[model samples]
Target: MRVTVLLAAAAVVVTAPRWLPARVVALRRKVFEKVNGDNVITFPNAAVGPDRFQEVYSHPAANGRSRGAGLSDLFWYWLSPGPEVHQEHLEAGPRYDDVARTTRALLSGPADALSAAAARCAARVLDETVTGRVTLVRLRDLMMPVWAEYFYELVFGEPCPREARDLIVGHADDVVSALKCTGLRHPARRARLTRYLARRVAAGDVRHPLPATLTPTEQVHYLQGTFYNTGVVQMSDAMAHLLLALAQHPDVAARLADDPADDRYFTRVLDETMRLYPLFGIAHRITTAEIELDERTTLPEGSVLCFSYPDYHASGHARPDVFDPERWEHTPVRESHHIPFGVAANRPCPAWRLSPLALRAATGEVLRRFTLHSTVAHTRSLPNRGACLLVRVGEPLPPRRLARIGALLRVRDRWEHVWRSVVQLVLGTVMVLHARRLRLAGRYFDPRPTAGCRVDQPPSSQENTA
Candidate 1:
């Protein structure tokens, strides 16, 4: 009996890497369902098919964000310090218009200029950091400082000071970490960046004029939350995904390297990358009015609609699971079930054009400097942060050495997933419950609006509509 028990234990240990992570994910999903309750309605469900996704998404009634939804509280909590003023979170109104105009103005530089700036920033980071012929890096960590500098230059029209860069990186990292549920929220780290932005605003250092509707403090939060927090973090994650995709597919990487001027091919690669690993998982909206899906089926007002990006991208493609940029060669991205930046009628990503241009430039710079390789798992969540090896140009690792590194990375990443899933479960649950208890979004939308109230103040119930 003792010998049998030891054998069973050994078998379980050997298989844990394959089975444990999936089990944890299942548990995590269950926990999420339990915490958020059944009020939320997911897209691609029976009533809302892939064909109707855009229509439903673009519906005039489907524009509510923070009001009457438990999930909004969770988003508000993670994005706090000024989630209210954050352009993405604000209800559709004058305030959102002002914020949107300011964002557009800030990002209005020529595409080539933005691209050049991104490449310059990336090259500078690599020159300072890559001290060895071969270096192992978490791609997200490597890209964060690059974007920090890029955005800082965009905001101030000057080189990013090391102090400011550090603060930006720190705050963005904390926000994404907490968002991924790999780490808890550190308000102090975020607060430091807020204070720095406040000082900058007070000094009249911002190059673009901020929204007139916001108070001075709200203006500081707006910069911190919108430009530094969301902009830096999303771009970093995007570049990490792009680099990791190149690392995993050596043939594609080689092709890209050989044809440096192949902008068309690179665009296909970028589109495919975004399809496979969309920056957003679930984008939720609360319906302000009844959505008439058909004469028989109607989604009532205040319904929470959760649009699944990964699921939608997975549909309407042959061998959707495969990563083949060639597919895009035959099919235009516009005709496909691809809304990477969301629909045009709704809140599309503000950086839609600028991001692709910047990513192309940054990626070109990295490819010029290093040959990227990785064997780690590449999921949309990217909890592992893209473990990759960067071999300096003209110095390649022997095949055997590369295989050994790949094997070790595979093992390390598998075990890490086992641990990370549990951490996500625990932290995700705590944060969801805490957000509910705080009722940040709920309270913000609960108060009735009065005349002369500040735009950033908790909006009135009537103002919550689309």
Candidate 2:
């Protein structure tokens, strides 16, 4: 018994750090369930698997009942969930009038609705996702400006103002550094992110960014930098989807292990991979102007609008209703109708290029190298589903190789470290200026015009659960 206990302890000592993050383990319970009968909290959202995903985004075809009437709906409500908004159902107006006439003139065909919609969605994607080419050829001249344009739009909107553009371009490392400088002490996430980004791009896993420079202290700040929100997004979706994908197609792990950058096949695998487990449940927007939707319902200026991504992915019932990766292999090109990035023209996720690529690299590496097989295969919705599969990964590789990998990783990791130090320096400055502001607990001031006003102002109700 003593020897057995010692062996088990030795195994644990040899393994722990390689396969898990402290937060993943801390939130593991919410990520999975022992006896999930009804609703369970996943990630501040109650995902009744995909059903919850569907309900929030679209009307149930049978009765036009909205899924917003569920526990999962509570998440956004908690964040200003009320002002219950509805879709702009032109049925309330002359259904066959202006919109139809306007659409017809451009496409000139009854079936052109599909084409027109596709074009509109394409234009929006171009505005939102595309920037200038930043390749080996374009890196020296085109890259900084390209990223500046994108970052500018990402900031307060509208090309980041000409004055600020200079700061962004000249202070590339400084900007990444500023984010790292938060020092909130969560494993220097940004610093790690830079290293991770470099590895994936170098390995041809995804597109690459321009090179950057920074000092050691700056790197530390970058690691601790502000991730904004996508860090939460990535964690939630990966936890849920990883389990589902493994369970549905047991061999995928092996294939990814053999080659992590098999983009053609693996991309498809993760295509529906995102569908089965989306990073978000739903996104909320308040109606900007009052207009009649479906005629029967009139939204005052304060109405809340929401669109659920999970629902759309989940709703195609016959189309791999379960967590099946093969379905993604043949998954058709989806439009606004099935968006996980949100239905609005503006998507809040900024590091999209890097994020998905990072997720892919991580998933491929872990699945191939470690083998994450959970006895359980489930989802809740709170964390991503409320519950995910509980994985049991293999121990890390041996010391000699480990030492070598660590050294190389460290040298390559300098970019992240330097970037973070610069960010921390900036954050330190911000802190000194607002030392009194920091005195406030939990709530940070937004200084924006409508800082305190209740947004998505619907008639107040008890906070919705999910």
- Give, for candidate 1, the lowest lDDT window spanning 10 residues: 457-466
- Candidate 2 — what's its lDDT? 0.36
- The pairs that clash in candidate 1 are none
After superposition, which runs of candidate 1 have C-alpha atoms over 4 Å from their true positions? 448-466
Candidate 2 residue lDDT tens string, 1-466: 9999999998875554433323333343232222112132221133233433333323222111122223222222222111122111111223223322322232232333322332332234233433322101111122233334332232222424445434334333333222223332222332343444334334543122211232232222221121212222233235346544654365876666677657776766666666666766545443334534335743444334444566656665466456555665555645323454443334234333343554454354335323332222233232112121212334444546444644654343333334433444444444333422221211111233234434422222222111
Evaluate model 2: give its TM-score: 0.38
lDDT of each: 0.89, 0.36
TM per candidate: 0.96, 0.38
How many residue pairs clash (N, CA or C atoms closer than 3 angstroms) in each of the candidate models, in the order given?
Answer: 0, 57
